[model samples]
Target chain A: MDARSLSIDGLPVPFDDGQTIMDASLAAGIFIPHLCHHPQFTPQGSCKLCTVRANGRYVSACTMPASEGMEVESNTPELNDKRRTMLQMLFVEGNHFCPSCEKSGDCLLQALAYELEMLGPHFPQFYPDRPVDASHPDVLLDFNRCILCELCVRASRDVDGKSVFALSGRGIGKHLIVNAESGRLADTDFSLADKAAHVCPVGVIIAKRRGFAVPIGQRRFDGEPISRRVDWLARRRADDEEEQ
Target chain B: MSNSEPSVRPATRRCLATTSLAGCFGCHMALLDIDERLFELIERVDIDRSPLTDIKRCGRCDIGLVEGGICNAENVHVLREFRRQCKLLVAVGACAINGGLPAQRNHLDLGQCLQEVYLTGPGIVHGQVPDDPELPLPLDKVHPVHEVVRVDYFIPGCPPSGDALWKFITDLLDGRTPRLGHPLLHFD
Candidate 1:
């Protein structure tokens, strides 16, 4: 395993030769805000939130491979502002009613907005009339909360070996579609145990009968911010590997 | 020389006003939830136009706090008035900042909504939509306060917590930018 060191925001991060900037940063316990680039699946680089300036050139960190002696800037004011605008666009593009949402405290999109101090949905609310599919007994698909990250699509395809979700259409007409012939989750083989069912970072694919079970103020990102949680998880994983 | 000198103190209480448009008065209640801090607030500022004061019109004020979305034509008029009168206007909650729950109606037809509530509702006695000219007609869709007028600041919560409001007001008075993050900036 050939390892090289790269600096992200003045912090030295060691990475494997083939590892992307996002992988290196996450492994080194640095939080680069992202929506689509899940560690388990192949990097898609769809959500540009993890975008960074590498040697004066802006590139998606999830897809850009880390190189030794390269200068990468992630947490700058300009970059964060760009990310905030992107988040604002996502907010208005979807009907994210955080107050009534079951995934309020746990939702990554809402958490990232909070992290960036996004004051409000700066863009006009599109309020597209997306449908809620509760056909599955174990899962509720609330399309309103979906930011179209396509994590479920990738996770189902690559990890679970079940392509239960996919993006349909393009531009403003783009949306998540069920893979079943009947266009319903129940018609498909999507169980609550599937990788796709757990990969949704928003309130879209919520497990039924467990709403508010963890309580409002006691959720994952409630006590500690997402960055801290990521750092803690990295450390815990390292500790587990050391024990093994 | 001291005996004939006139007192040189100017009345310097910052005037504050607040109003609710097309939302539940939850945000106003949250404002009142400032509780004992209301005494300190009153000491530093004068309540010119608010639900608490029951003032019909908003006079010229230092700050105006607006809650709820613009659902009707009257909301637009009042919001424009607030923008005109106040030096700094703050959209106080999710409703005022992003249309919140009422904006959910934007998905359906306004006529359908009116029909459901007025005519086809379970407990409808008259079974007809009200046609009084005195009532302000609703806009095609609910809009956040910023869509109607320039909002100087925003506090983005369903109903921003009492403490968050207190901190924001005090920060403004102390001549500092109100920093809403993490614990203070919950949309839910």
Candidate 2:
């Protein structure tokens, strides 16, 4: 219980000097819903799902540093409603046929939608004619399911050092593209083992021929909810830190 | 408090009807999967025009649960009938909410599909695209139930789980807003 602490939803939680609100909250075992703000990657603040009210101002928790004595509001009804709308927009923006998708059970977008109690894709479907890149022998890139989170792009450039993926276009037209001149995944040096392949939050990048291997009922986010898993991960990390 | 107060009577049970258009009736199966708890539900609601009762036509009902996408002219007619007969219309399961498996053929031309299935397909005896006035004409593309008519609610899943259907029905009966939370909300 440090004296310098910010109150999130009236609960006082201490933060390191330079830690973002999301970082502080995660460290304190508070699960704020997010997509693009992975712990291993720098906070891009692209996905606005982690937006929280700090001292009566709405800001992305992943980018905004936690300040002492600040009143931050997370999990409010209004905010949850906004998040639900955002999820709906994402659902319609892409051809996210969750029932037929390989990543449906493990998808963060689908999981968050479930956690938020989004009954349906409230918005109309776009049904974009995006191409599937099954050119790679071991991997497949289904662009139709891409939410434009850019996690794969970030992971490819920052972690894998391949720079295999990048975002193209602007606004609603913005989409993921391959780095190769041929605009095909087969032309790129992307392997099944690349960090980018495993970092997708949705069903965009999948290992070929390995779909539905885990079975529907036994998959991630099937038995336990995503919030519980996040809390469990946070606690495990905290225990590890204490040991070190 | 007066001892001679008027005796209160329990409100009449709400009537509910359900139908499947072009679906596999999996959504209806999920509804039946409510199992022994359906007896408890029976106490609160009167089911009409559902597959369980083998009712062909829907009478006037409070709530209508519709499953499947519109693949043919007959589906459209039944869907419109459900809309007219019910107060609140709920599109249940993936096919009803979105053009589920049937919509997969949406990418290809309907004529091409018919040709491949009938004339060009392997092991066809007297291959012909049947054209009869009595048969329902296939639509150009599979359409979700919402695309054809206004749907009050949508339950998104290949087939929404029995628990999901039960909770939704009970919540509606209780005059509470229906919602599916995690562990109960799945699309596959």
TM-score of predicted chain B versus true chain B for each candidate: 0.91, 0.92
Candidates in order have lDDT scores of 0.87, 0.85
What lDDT tens digits, residue by residue, belong to model 1 across residues B40-107? Answer: 88888989889999998999999999999999999999999999999999998999988989998999
| Model 1 stretches astray by more than 4 angstroms | A1-3, A232-244, B1-12, B123-126
For model 2, the superposed segments whose C-alpha errors exceed 4 Å read A1-3, A232-244, B1-11, B42-44, B122-126
TM-score of chain A of 1: 0.93
- The number of the candidate with the highest DockQ is 1
Q: Which model scores highest in TM-score?
A: 1
DockQ for all models, in order? 0.78, 0.57
Poorest lDDT segment (10 consecutive residues) of candidate 2 chain B: B3-12
RMSD to truth, every model: 3.4, 4.6
